[model samples]
Target: MKETLADDLNLLSAFCGVRDLTDLSQNALYQKYQLKKADAFVLFGGSILSGIDVLITAMNNQVATNYLIVGGQGHTTNALRLKINQFYPQIPTKNASEAQMFNAILQLKTGKTADYLEEKSTNSGNNITNLLQLLETHELKKDGLILCQDATMQRRMAATCSKFAPNTTIINYASYKVKVMEKDNQLHFDRKLLGMWEMDQYITLLLGEISRLQNTPSGYGPAGKNFIAPVFIPQDVLAAFYRVAKLFPNKVRTANPAYAKSLEN
Candidate 1:
C-alpha cells in the first residue's frame, strides 16, 4: 500500500502542532501538579494573527493570571506587518517589535494589554532565556505556563522551556494547526485563515522544526547545539519527517548564522 504525500503530512502535523491547552490535552499533568490555572499564558510573537487572537481567548477564559508577549524583530517581522495591515488595519505597527505589534492587536481586540512584554529576544533560544529573566525580575509565576507559538515550533518550544525553566510545567498551545490538502496536484489549505502562510513557506516551517527537533549531533537538542534539553522523538514522528522531507526536497529552513557561530564555539 503506497501512502500518499498527504498521509505523511497529516502524521507530521499531528506530531508537531498542539491545540489549546487544558483539560483537553494534558489534564493528568495538571492534576498531578494540583494546578488550577497556569501561572502565565505567554504568546511568542510571529506573523500569525490567530496566535494573538487565540491567546486573548485563553486570557478571557481565565487560563492564566499573567499574560506575556515575547519577541523582537526577526525573520517573520515584516510578514507580520503585512498581516497587521490586512487584518488589523487600525493598529499602528510603526517600527514596532514583534511583541509590540502583537500587543497592539491584543489590546484592540480585548481592550486590555499584556502584563509583560519581553521585546529584546530575537530568536527562540533567547525568547525563552529573556522570558525567564523577565519572570524573575517581575516575580511572575513560573510553576506552570501555557505557551503559544507557531504550530511548527510548538514541540521545540516545549523542549526549550524545559531546558531553561526545568522545574516549570509547560503546555504547548500552538497558534495554528496547519492542514495541507492536495488539489490539482498542488497543496493548499482547506480555507484561508487570517495570517495564513504561503504553501511553500508553510512547508519550509514544518520541515524545519523536525530538523531542529531531531536528537542528532547537529540538532537543537543537548547532543547538538545544546539550545534545548534532550527530549524524546518518537520513531513514528521521525519516520514521517523523513518521508515528507524526501517528498519535499530542499524546503527546510536552515538555522540562523548565530546558531552556526554557537556551534563553532
Candidate 2:
C-alpha cells in the first residue's frame, strides 16, 4: 500500500506536536500562565542570534523582571558568532558563552542586560540542569515560567522541564519560522523564505530531536533513564519516524546512531 499525505502529516504532527507550536502565541502564553505572575523567564540557547531575538522581545515586553540565558558552545556556536559579528562588529564573540554572546546582542538591540547568564550548559539536557542549579544558587524559585527556545525544541524542553521542575508552570514561546515541510516528494525548506539555517542542517536537527523523544533505552527521555526528557511517542508517530528515516537514510542515520540501532532491534 502507498502512503498518503494524511499519513505523512499525521506522523509529522505527532512527532512535532503541532498543537503546542501553534499554541505558543503571546495570548496563549498569557491565557495559560500570565507572565506578570511569573518570577522570571528563561532562554535555552542553541540557535544563536535567532534565540536572542526572542529573548530580547520577551525582555522588552516586560515579560518578567528577571531573565536567564543558558548555554555553552555546541556545534553551532561558530556560525552564530559569525552572524553576531556581522551586526555588531565591535562585540567580541570568541571564547564567549552563548549567554554572553546573546547578552552582547541584547545590549546592542535593546540597551538592556539579561539578569543572569548560565554558561556551563553544553546541550539541551544541561540547559535545564544548569539553569535549575543556577536558580538554586541565586535562591530564586520559578513559580510561573516562560521558556524561550527554538520552536523545534519546545517539546523536548517542556518534557525535560516537567520531569525536573514539576512545580513550575512553564509557558513555552518559540519562533514560527523554524518549520519542517514536504515538497516535491521530499522534505525541504525554502532558504529564501526562512533563511535561519541550511535545509539539510535543520532537517538533521529535527530528526535528531525525534530520535531523542523515543521511549527506548537508547533514547534520551525517561526510558533511557537520562532524566533529560519525558516524552511519549505514539506507535503511529514512531512508525512515521521510521518511515521518514528510511526516506532520508543518510541524513537520519548520521543524525542519530541510536535511532538507527533501535530500528534494527
Best-fitting candidate, measured by lDDT?
A: 1
Q: At residue 126, what lDDT does model 1 achieve?
A: 80
lDDT of 2 by residue, 1-265 (tens): 8765435544553455322324434555566555444567787667535667667666666666578887776656676777777766888987998888888877887888889998876666667777888888999977777777665566777777887788877666654343346667775543333226565665556666778777688677667846555677777767766776676666652332221222111
Model 1, range 144-246, lDDT digits (tens) per residue?
8988888777878888899888999888778876677888998777767788888778778888888888778978887887888887878877887888888
Cα misplacement distance, residue 166 of candidate 1 (Å): 0.9
Top-scoring candidate (TM-score): 1
lDDT of 1 at 107: 80
* TM-scores for candidates 1 onward, in order: 0.90, 0.79
The CA lDDT of each predicted structure is: 0.79, 0.65
What's the lDDT for candidate 2? Answer: 0.65
- Residue pairs in candidate 2 whose N, alpha carbon or C atoms collide under 3 angstroms: none
Once fitted onto the true fold, the runs of candidate 2 whose alpha carbons sit more than 4 angstroms away are 1-28, 86-88, 180-195, 253-265
